[model samples]
Target: MKFQTFKVCGLVFAFLIGSAFLGSSGSALASQKVPISFNDYHGYTGTVKYIKSVAKAYPNITKLIEIGKSNMGRPIYVLVISNMKTGTTIDTFVKLRNKRKEGVKNVPPMKPYQGKPGHWICGSTHGNEYTGTEVCLYTIDKLVSGYGSDKEVTRLVDGQTFYVCPVVNPDGLYNSIEKGISQRQNSMKKDDDGDGKVNEDGYDDLNGDGHITWFRYKDPKGRYVIDDVDPRLMVRLRRNAKTDKQLYSVIREDRDNDGDGERGEDSERGIDLNRNFPEGWWKTDGMAGGRGNYPTSAPEIHAIAEFFTNNTNILMAQNYHTSGGFTYRPMGTAPPNQLHPKDVAIFDMIMGKKYLEIIGEEVPEAWKAPGSLARFKEELEKKSKNKYAIARGYELPRGWRASYNEARDRRYGYGMASDWMYMQFGAYAITTELWNPQKDIKDFPQFTGPDARIEAQRALLKYQDEKYGGKLFIPWKKFEHPELGEGEIGGWIPKYRSNALPGEPLLNVCEKHWQFELFRAGLQPEIVITDAKARVLYTANKANSAVVSQKGDLVSIKKGKSKGKYKIVEVTAVIENKGKLATHVARGAQLAGNREDIVWLIGDRDKITHLQGTKFQKLGVIEGTQKIPGYTGRPGAGPAEQRRMQRMPRFIPPGYPMFFRMRGARLEPTQVKQTGPKREVRWLIAVEGNTPLKVVVTSQKGGTKVKNLLIQ
Candidate 1:
């Protein structure tokens, strides 16, 4: 295939000139089991069907779960992709002591995939931002189809789990894509105009053209003027700007359906689902800050919140949006100071670096040379006015930034999903605004200066003209409006403008994001029981209770005689985190309903008796194999800055002596030392009749692993 770029009417355009391959390539097509096409958008119905097909086709690696339903009763789904037979949870191995007599079926059973580390990927939180839906579907196709074919994909599917929700707002997505009306919020039954009826006056296809496009009419007070380069494109004049061209008023191809004198004011448009989360939904003035009556008030958001609450294994999450082609990490509702130093390094140095590289953005110098962050911080202090930037050592890159308005010191919005996921759920959550025409499209000319937007619009119009045969745009046609009088009805189809142009451009955006997510998935903490051993120290025909007494430097245990055979066994197990990141964020375990990593010794309840260590021990946190670049905090670091400096690494600096005394006193370093991810746990137990022993390690996000011990 050959492609060329040329200048046309002050705009650079590229089109498919020719191709070497005459027919479709076997490898290019989707899996034979579930075929998908990116040439067009797949609304709610298509998405449901495709996911159902995938779940049916790949039963071993996929399970379709309906997390919740939308206001319109559409099922919101999450497809779990993992080796279903391979994982286990703590709840499964540990039996509950008491059972309630009342039949209350509130808690659902945990799935096998929930036992493994989880990466959540959801799209279409906003109905009109359906580009996210396609990206999610593309990611799903990549995961499912590449499972057996790609090595990395196979490992991820086998070890980790992916919960991909294609459409978070089903009614909004369906109305936008299927009904050809740009509905950005979820659907509701409330009457917006309060005309004693629900959903009475919405967008109506006045011209009966199937699409609810724009209707333009000449008006002296209108803010828009016909573009000189591309007459079809509407150019909005700058505020208070004088324009000689005829000003026009543009509105959706709609009218007053219920004779309310208002146009589409009482439509099914509901609360913004993204703003219906539980975090920062309340204002300081004791008022409702976000959409709906309260946080998680909308059915969609409530479902999501409930799902995250139940599924604690998810450590990484992504909420996809469109147009900006950038990612927003957490703390959107607060300033940068709220984030922990360790988490900041992980989100920026590791994940943000990879994201910038994937999107072809320059990484910050501080990120590249994290060891010299202090120097960078000094340099930034002199030149940068942003306090957060000066403190952090570098300004956030354009491609990766927080939604918090740092310059003005204001929150971006209330009740955002990513903020909730990070602050409360303890996940490395982010919201990625996908799609940039100049970046995603090959040979798409860069536009700049005052006329940049108009020039880009012109170029895109021409590009679509050549590539899509002008099918995406509806040509302006004369039409008589019911109330607004004479006008022309036409414009770029609503879905095609804000979203990535389907086919090649959409595929490009999807691939880059998928690659970035794959890298992130590889970073999830993987806890494994590397070694387990059981050795019998003593055996007796009958025993009752054992008592231990210590004298001077010696300890002895005395056993009482009983009518049962007993063998005292020493069990030791080595648990290690083999992945690239820690099991939890700095404050993850400290959050409500979360706990530190734990290791348990399991056997028959009545047959085994713990003699030394408890049945389970809390492993503070199992760090990952990979070292964080810019982070210097050690295990004993305190919350206060002064205390953190006091508890530095145990190893002395080059100029310092191994042992040092302060103020004439011989102050020795603490004897207790905390090491790396590996932890060796031991338990002494009395086993009767050679009962089987098992060692289990469970981390909320690091995953669960169990090993059987052989008593020798």
Candidate 2:
């Protein structure tokens, strides 16, 4: 033991939300946890402006950053929330959760938890999946209002950073919101089919309704038929000689727009922003824009790719999608066996089961009005009399079991952003497919058939009767078509029955997602400087002791025969990993393109070596969660990972305490194991009165920790 040092070790709070602190808690100047409802869900532009308003209202902890512009020149916004302090002070001390005797088994007490990681969240990757925009606004609202007031919120703001990009595809998201038609991609100029043409024709709200829903009509020989159990539900008509029910083919509400021999197949801006990431990008030819000509082809995606690449401390990320109501984890293209063996356990049981329970609890069940079923039957009969043709869309998500990977859903999606983040940067990525109507239906419904969309259709019908007085169901109306001749166009309003929730009770559902997201962020590795101190070594008096030759600037000696003393001090600190997961994920460590952060001792420049293992990167502060530099200013070269070391091999187990010395006089170092957490150990060095021995530790997810001590 040297000079007495007081260490304020934060008792790593495992709970993310609804947590109470027993400390010197402070209140935020202007903070309130006000709930923003979906009375009229904020569309893309509205959501963007709302985020800005939140940042303005909470200028101390929030900043509205424009990352880049969409293809259609829509500004991409990322709301950054933090304590807004740039410099470190004595009060900005390291709270190494348990830097003292309570050091966990694996990691050591030599390194302190450095900085809080940035938690990345975004929604509306698929423009038509409108719920994401709302979720983003809701998240912004949470961070803005909860900054210093809410205990959990204060912790996240002061400790960790939050990045919320509400609408990744702003143009398309707003188009879907305003026009009831979302091209599902940015309004870019690209000939999707390479048809020597560009975005000529596709999709039309022919009925003058605000949605491009199903264009259903009777066909003697069609590929789909109305389900016998639920007349409102459409099912695939499998081949069978005995079954003579008429089949129908439902097309998009359009005719042959481009005259490309395909009906409403190609549209302008056919890029799938989600499928334009830099990881595992391959031309699937399975779906349009499934694989852009090159990775990060979309400007929005490019901005996001570079934004994350420039930031290495992001701990976890969630990409919100819709309708499936399932939590999807990585190895997007790889099957369970193809990925790290441990990933299955992480994805299936931990991720799936936990979120399943949470979502099940958050969203309520659908209420069918009494006698609505009889009206539904009458409506079904009237539609049946019309003998309208039935058609099916097979590619939709159907079976939603706890671990329903979309029923053999293993294509790794050519350029899915989720997979890109996980595979390229080792970021813990999750695709949260929101809102499965069946999940809200009575009996806790399960997708028994190949596709459970029909059950969702049934639930929607019931919801319409109960919520909207059966108005959601549009009666089949005749429409003369140039290509398909006389036909009818009528069906459910895609936006009405889709993931969009109408009332406030479902507001809880939106809030519950935040619960899950915050929970995941709590897993960020935190290395706390549990204890730190410095001791004075023997002071050599120049007048009495023999003058020793100095080996460099380790210790400077005064003139001989002089009444002077040379003092040397030793410094040490206790460090512990408070996060549940390892500092860096296994996959992230093995990827060359990912960051391999290390701990370093900052002493006299002459005493330290800039060798490969003992290198130094001056990450002065954990300003990771703030606005990304060069976001809007820089012209993105391409995907950020392209500039990374994608083939490098490096990995360190959680809590690995490495050793280093800023040498002055050669001395034996403390003995310890090759790697893994270590108990307090002494450093051999020379120092003048009160020398500042600073130690900086860094983990990809834990941000950075810089602590200094004075020794005399």
Candidate 3:
């Protein structure tokens, strides 16, 4: 689809333009220019009408497919951009293949049979992960407009199809936008703090500065004190290094609206999207971080899950977040010993290498998490015997220099997304923390990079403050709280503080990360036709009557070197498949299948069955090994038995790799090797062929390369 390039504009101007374009089209659209400024990024509200605006602008290329609806009745629009023809669905290809399988050989090839794998990009599963939404929108704009123009972009798009959902949590995202609050939960309105009442009271704009910031008050028993090193930052008071008995504490508003003493004692939401995943989902109250009674409780999460279930062609996945600098990979809850050695090695290579190039740091090994998408991927591989390498949780650095503890925002937990993906899908999955607030500091080393701009954050903050009338920030002010009467409530706004960098610098950061994401998409698992040919073997007939019929089905006899030529099938074909798993868990009657339909086959003249090799299984099989029609059925379960199968653990033998896809990065299989002294460290390397391609190496000592090999 063609996208109109938008010129940069103020947030207010951008909102007006975007709103005006909503659900309208025709000659009036000719003069419309989309504003591409930082304000424009934040102004997006994910409205259905706004989707129509995007559609109208790129009528030829943009398509609004309603994958599902959110809990608040918001349509989950999937904006698909590709040069491939429409009305060409994966179903169509499947149906055609079934028809071909039913016919005999020596028949004309299925009329115009053409099929291609696809790639997926999703955003905003967490309500507070807003940067991903903007970055995704920007990516859509770039891809649609740059198609047939930009060489790299064009190659990526044309060679592979793209499915993008700008906002996975429409209700949460829109609610927060409307309320001007940075709420991480969905719109279920439960008691989060668990004081009493449901969402009765949350962090308020006590200072009226359009932000929820830390509020420190003077108390005789306070435990915090300003750090002598940096007053701008906070530090825990040392036990023996105090003079006065003054006490300090960070406080927000009370939860109960009726001035009740209880805080958010009764305000809890339905579930945390990240924790709702099926893998390692514990039944504890806070196990899944507010995961509802069961998986897929929220409509938004369900919709996302359904989309991934249907689109099995997707092999690579990427989910964007913010507030951290590290890139993490799967096996979240699994102990280091339980982690697949090969998978760990691969993750270290891809993530470690990328981190060094982008953030100039090495990803740390060994972190634990549960109920994550990474675990789901691991389960998928175990269930389907498909080697789907999925990665989740790309965490951006919370503190730019790693020494700022308060700056460590969990909003961008790298280990969460990366580890989940590696466990679920054999393909790649990554969660990139889009922006870092520390990067906004003028003297930050990142500003000196090739893509850096002078005082970018200052320019963005100035623009946002002026355009929004400071409604997007928190100005210093005092308020009378029931808990702490007469205390200053002003600190840092959600978007203006330590969580996110200034929008202007953030845009550049997003662009650079998006480039890396594009590179990641290129690394998704692909299939190639290494060889194809037919050969005839002659054997001696049981009875040497005359010359035995060489064409006999069994015991055919053709003595004395028969004059026959063998056709050597040789062609190089790259198969690109990007997959996505919407939510980690399934809800209601629907269970996201453990296997995606990424398979390849080579058949003979009979055509009754074809040799099959899939991303899940490294080995290939001859046709007719199984009686299943499309090879879509689960192993050990017959067609009739599969219908009655419940959501229980199923065993899958080795050689078959299962796959799953989600919002974030794509993952692929890699071999792991332990080298160096004591073999205490392990490295992950990508496997291209029989040969091993070194990606990462680890050691007891910290350094760049190990024995000439990079150890990122």
Candidate 4:
């Protein structure tokens, strides 16, 4: 089938002739299982090469485009997969995104996916966190290959357009693959030890085993000891333990290069692309986790930030990571318990449900609830019948344990990507930690004590032995260290646990995470103006309120009998949100400065506009909190969107950019006090002519709608 492009229209013309596509080819309809050739998530030259081949093979459905390059000149490729719905969805979004950053005016925000809304999945940022990259590749393959072959796949691809950036940190991933899996930061070398040297002394395969494993040497003043039952594992010494035998000291597999007597402390200094985002960015010099001198200082992360912040059409976003079967959100660096109590409760409850459906994990509802501790007590008594109600004051529940250190409830992260995307932009952003070995075990033991770690080790080892013939773990062996003398340099290899999931279980992990991603896409806000109704003001009295001559999208009213030659008439349009979340989310509404949620009237009206530096005459915004109006809202008094948009899900300190769309010269977007759950906003205007009225309603979060009402 052939398609026609839409000509750009000025104010009053609402219709944007959507793009169209031909039906699938006969052979393209052949459905088959994802070829292991492309299905494997572990390593197939990364997503860099895979997307190109997929797009080439399926040109009608997939478009391979590069947004920018990484710090090391690696192309940052994005695959826009659509079902011939291409001309409208992908290009419009890309244009809007590009122009928004440039503060382009007169360009309308991209419409919702013509047939379905759009979704963005950021595969990976930390090079070593290979799970997200794998999942992204697997997902892209599923989409392009499964189209027309699988019913669900056909529905998804045909309905929704996907922007998949499989690997966000190309330099870092290549570094890990080329040097060692332990290479966590990207290739932007820095002076980690602040000694005015870069990449001077970092990890080395001290034993020349082609890997970077830890080293433990026998020493009289050591704080660790080799597990007697599992000599391959080492545990720190417990306090008050009586022992006479020589203990051991553990250090990373490296040698001191700066003569500082420290090993691996100043090696391969680079920014952790994940921690270099503007949100929660650490400004102090020499911060940990590869945080660069400034937020988005790295080329890769800055390009990504610039891309997504401008692309407001993104409904859901996920930054994939591996190990520890955990799903995390914003506030990675700050204390988790300090977020808005209600927001925390809602995130936990809603995210918990998704987790159970996807990874079979629990989000621990016993954590913290909304309202104060006193409110919790009162509700507990009323609901729990005072039997199991808490008699003491509220205490924050013991949070999750860190996989590497087994440290509990540790709160620390700065400049994490997920927090920026979600907290600032208000898009549903999730950083997924894939593969928790505990999920595969029955009676999972805790990592509380040395003995407990040994038991946990035993469980994992036994499982690995039974499952993969013990091929995953690198057996402990004695080796000679250059500076530390004789020691053991064997433990769980990077692939064995911390980094990517082993090749065997990777498929299952990808499948589950993909399902969760689809679930999120299903929840994206779909804006609708089907419920919009227009009325013309007729008359008013002390008892009889202002009336309209007729109702509908368009109605013409003549000058009324008010003893005057001409009389003004009011035209009110009611726009309703019919999606799950508010038109724009609660968080997005707060950060959307100047880019308020409202309906636009394009006609011969003078002085109306949202842009500040443009040359073209513009329409005026009526002004409200979230909309454009003149009422300070108080709960049930003002428009629903305004009441909700002003709230901050979490109060982050100043410094980070609010990633909102739309180009407005206002100091900030309107502060919305309310978001939604089936709400309506009324657009009221006064006009004199009987021309066609094209109204565009956009809820920064909900989809956009253009309705034409001809008035005569």
Candidate 5:
């Protein structure tokens, strides 16, 4: 059938009625339900139409950005949603909020705390996994439609920005739609069947039923026997318990279409997008499911990698997939015992509680499979210290099995998605199987009696045939098989089975799953500056009759009266990591320099004094000095002459130490300097005192002056 827009008129009417009760505010009034159903979303044109509808519906809040183009030249669009009033842009919010507190006053300041970190939700990384794309579309609709109406929605939108990429593998998705069967690889064709030829043959509809159903051939000695209780159910005889050798019944199909003895073994396959990430990239066959020889080998995967690399603000990730009824976390490949102790503890605390509340079960405490997206997220956290979570591998609900006794016992337990997330990224990632076809039935008990399970399968087939029409099962049809002569190609059709249910009920399930995903997104790590402080330390060294200043010559004594010269050299401050994590240094904080000025000098007729120290030591002089004959005099030099004098170092005795004092502060010299014009001047200094004595030293040049000197 051609791609047609299937409007759910009845569903939309019901939604409008229900929305009236839910919509107390006018914001919800503007939301109009589009006439699009998930069943028709198998085509690129349909997907684009839905995306455009969302964009046009919420133009003020939703913006569609073309991050890149797909191999087919289709625009890969990213939908960004944020509150305009708060001025909270995606990258801007993350960058500004991570700034240092001391530098908050400069230029543009951050907005007041909004109470949550920004969030990102991506979908359809796997081409065959189309459920996430539909879910993302629904989520966008919910967020925009409820912006001013729903309290929780408003809080989420205002508190954090949401970035959504609906389809990461559009090429694969489009191909699946056109081919009438979902293929896991991207659009690039390859020799997947391995017949030593490329894209030569693949599965064909031998029954001409417009669907690919399992084929069964009659064989008297078949290993598979019809259950005594239910003819619809087939059971394999155990190898050891078999009475005689029997034929094996594999999925019934002929390999080659043309009249040939050889089976069709070659068909096209594309790159596996999950294996194309940069974090745990492996060559083809080097890692589990690694498709290509290098990362970004596929155009679609390359586009996604480029998008994420540029948008570093994506803190949380959830990848949706088919039926398994469980929430999964991270550390995909590492043994559960090998997980980081602290990280494991945190993971248990968060996901453990969430799973119990949401799914009524806890994730099995074990390690998961390798080379999955969950492992990729863990590697990302290790590399950037940013948190990422993966919610994948959801199983179909058991409802599908309720109708058939044979299918009932096949229900599997929750698989990997949620656990992989918690173990790896420390964020809660959930994989929820959206729909359970086996609804309203108690968990199916294992059949112990003869033919009980087969009987159940017969009943299920009868119910499916009666209620959902013959869509669930293919009527047996005769076809001239290439090898089997005359054979019937018929069994279970795709959507009618439990795994692939109709779009209406599945969409509802997706809506609920999307809510949980939204909750997980809201909880991503939000790093903020809780507190900051600074401390200063002063060090000085003094020797007999001479002083070495560690912080320049802020202390000096001349003629026993204390100081004729003193200057504040450098204030040494060290920023400590008092918080739990390392704090980044602000861009401009005046870290290495003196904050004030004080000049150092010695007074005498010909008595020369020296100052020695290294430059850029955070203790260097102010690089300028003036000399005068007397303590009280006007300055005689300008900045030009001062600069010339600064080039020359004043070297004191070899062992002389340095002393330091702040400008306008008292100066107490521990050591004294003895120098005069050949005993022409005799000076006696007082040694004992409770407080340092202040002495103002003035230059004979009449312009230079120094204060804050004391004698101890």
Candidate 6:
């Protein structure tokens, strides 16, 4: 119930120490509907419970979806946060041609939230790296809790869609936390050859302490020595360091359960989920560069791929990992040249700069002076051997970097989710390694130099002792190993060792990442029908009685020779992208299954005939109002370039095919195009009687919006 205030880099942070921070409602004492605590880690069971509660408590804004199942048959859940009734899609208005009487269920109906721009955030791709799970849960708590109480949150919840998948690898999280086994990869039930001869030499709690901690024994060839400052900690020695201290061999608190004389040989561990995506999965040598026989071979990765396939509205994607407290943008498999310069600007100068600031890291000098990039690029070309770095004008900072090994000029890994999402799906995707004890922990001592890791470990032990009463660590105790003569069974608990320490430290990590994602969400493109009106240029009892022609601002109508009840109406609509980023990234529309933003004029199809513009007009990519920092490249394609049409073939009367073709009138479709953040579209149509009209704008990644047109 007590609140404490502190400052990090002059920005004051207020957090509740003993209990979880109650989400916003009115006052500090207001009870949170779905109260959540970061006091300790929430494994799969707890996470599922909390998310389900949020979905039930906030039914209007939240829907819990089981996207798919893991290898262990555990459901992978994605909690969607958005107003369920506020949005609409192009499918609702546009009628398709050649519809079949018996419908095939190839594609499911688009949900209302799909009509809005989507931001996807998932955590725990690796089982042992479950710190991201806590952050994901924390983000969900902030969003659902702050919905009606906070202004910015309210606007976001009402306007945009947020897909939060708290646990991408459910079995890994369960095993890591609940079973106390540090499983980095997901769990698989099958063996290598599917012969049911699964290896069972997984880590066993030999000490019966209910924790799969480390066991250390004396050995001349041991690679670890007791820390001078903290005896409870064991520090690893350098490969060739000659230390005069007693050496110790350390292993997980496990024994040969199957009497195979080997430990953890064939555990339930599956392939690395991050290395199971579809981008750069095959090497140039025709070898499988990624894990598994092919991309998405793992069940967990398959679910993620399928979910992304169905949700094309997602433009911003984040896959969370642990321990490093840094971010990896995209193109990890390829070089920086693979990314468009404009995207690079947005990723580095915009998102990267903000991330470094949030984590209290120094922003690169070149990033601050984006206008001086030309000079920086020149400087890099002369001094740096990394061509990608030279092209980007600066090397990526430690806090925000690509996983690709730029120094060695080599790929980091294959089938990375971020690379797949960006190159193939055209999303602004990134993988953020969450938690850094040095940065996230308030007032933790700064460790540097050769022995900095040992020093940091000592500080963390002391901090946990003072703050958490030392329960976080298990004191080393001598135990008689069933196989070895003697050893001590103790060390930091598996999950607590590498992840963000519980309570304030974990909360701090969660807050910083939530803020970053919130900022990213704010950048999603928002398409809107700003202004729309239908003007009745001419009206007559019969369609042939009125033919319309425009000269300057004046319109003249004369008797014509077409058919029926006619009213020549001119519909003008102003479409704009009011959000921060453009409707799509560079070349995003050209990606398969993606298209340029389109505006549709809807009415009774049978009654209205388009005399000028088509019923639906391609708006191309509607530029956003926000200017991208550090990017001076050409903007996205404007309406004029996007709406270009081929010349219509001259129409020839049916009966007099060749002889009378010269006397026949030539006909062509009319189109009006404009550019930039806004477009003015005009359509001349003949309406039979007084047909109601509406204008709808649809963008694959931007969002869909509609405005009813009133005929005057």
TM-score of each: 0.89, 0.71, 0.57, 0.68, 0.55, 0.88
Per-residue lDDT of candidate 4, residues 1-712 (tens digit) = 1222333342224432221112343334453233434222344254656677677778778777677777667888888877765323333322243453333532334433433456788765777777777788778877777787667777667656688988787777765655654556767566778888887877777778787767888988888877777666676777867576669998767788788888767755476787788766753465544377788888888777777765665656788877677777555654443233333433444544566646664433333332254565665566553232243112222222211111243445678877777666656666777766565344555466646556766777777777677766777778888787898887766645665345546667777777777666555555555554445543223121233465677675555333222112333344544444443343344454424455555545442222221211111121212221111222321222343555636777698678855564445432323343333344344443344455565544454556666542
Q: What's the lDDT for all of these models? A: 0.87, 0.60, 0.45, 0.58, 0.44, 0.85
Sorted by TM-score (best first), the order is 1, 6, 2, 4, 3, 5
Which residue window of length 10 is worst by lDDT in model 1? 15-24
Clash number for candidate 5: 52
The deviation in Å at residue 498 for candidate 3 is: 4.0
lDDT of 2 by residue, 45-159 (tens): 6786677677777777777778888887889988887777731321133344545333443322321111457778998888877776677677777767766567787777777
What does candidate 5's lDDT look like per residue over 438-535, in tens digits? 33123433344775545545665766665567567776566666665654566666434433344554565565566666655444432221222111
lDDT of 1 by residue, 237-282 (tens): 8988997889999988989888878889999999899899988888
Best candidate (score: lDDT): 1
Model 6, residue 562: distance off in Å is: 8.3
Name the regions of candidate 2 deviating beyond 4 angstroms: 1-30, 33-35, 86-115, 192-197, 226-236, 239-246, 256-266, 283-290, 341-349, 360-412, 441-456, 504-508, 541-565, 593-597, 603-681, 688-691
Deviation (Å) of 454 in candidate 4? 2.2
How much is 161 displaced in model 1, in angstroms? 0.9
Question: Predicted candidate 3: what Cα RMSD to the true structure?
Answer: 17.3
Could you tell me how far off, in angstroms, the CA of residue 628 lies in candidate 4 after the best superposition? 26
Q: After superposition, how far is residue 272 of candidate 6 from its true place, in Å?
A: 0.5
lDDT string for model 3 (1-712, tens) is 1232333345568888887666233323332334244444452364445556766776555667787776566677888665544223223223343343334532223211112334567777777677777777777766765655566776666545567887877766765555556556666765565556566755565555545566777776777755444333334556766755445676654334546665554443345676555444552344444265655667776666556554544445676665564433444433332233333333444434554456545432222222253555565455443232223222322221111121222132212333344344333455665665344333444445632332334444554566557655554456666566766565445544423444566666667667766765555332222222222222222312224554546656555443232222221122211222111111101223332222222222221111121211221111111121111222243221343365456887788668657655534422222211111112111211122111111100010011111111
Off by over 4 Å in 4: 1-44, 82-118, 149-161, 191-200, 239-246, 256-262, 282-290, 333-345, 361-411, 441-450, 531-576, 601-695, 707-712
Q: What is the Cα-based lDDT of residue 37 in candidate 5? A: 61
RMSD of 2: 15.2
- lDDT comparing candidate 6 with the true structure: 0.85
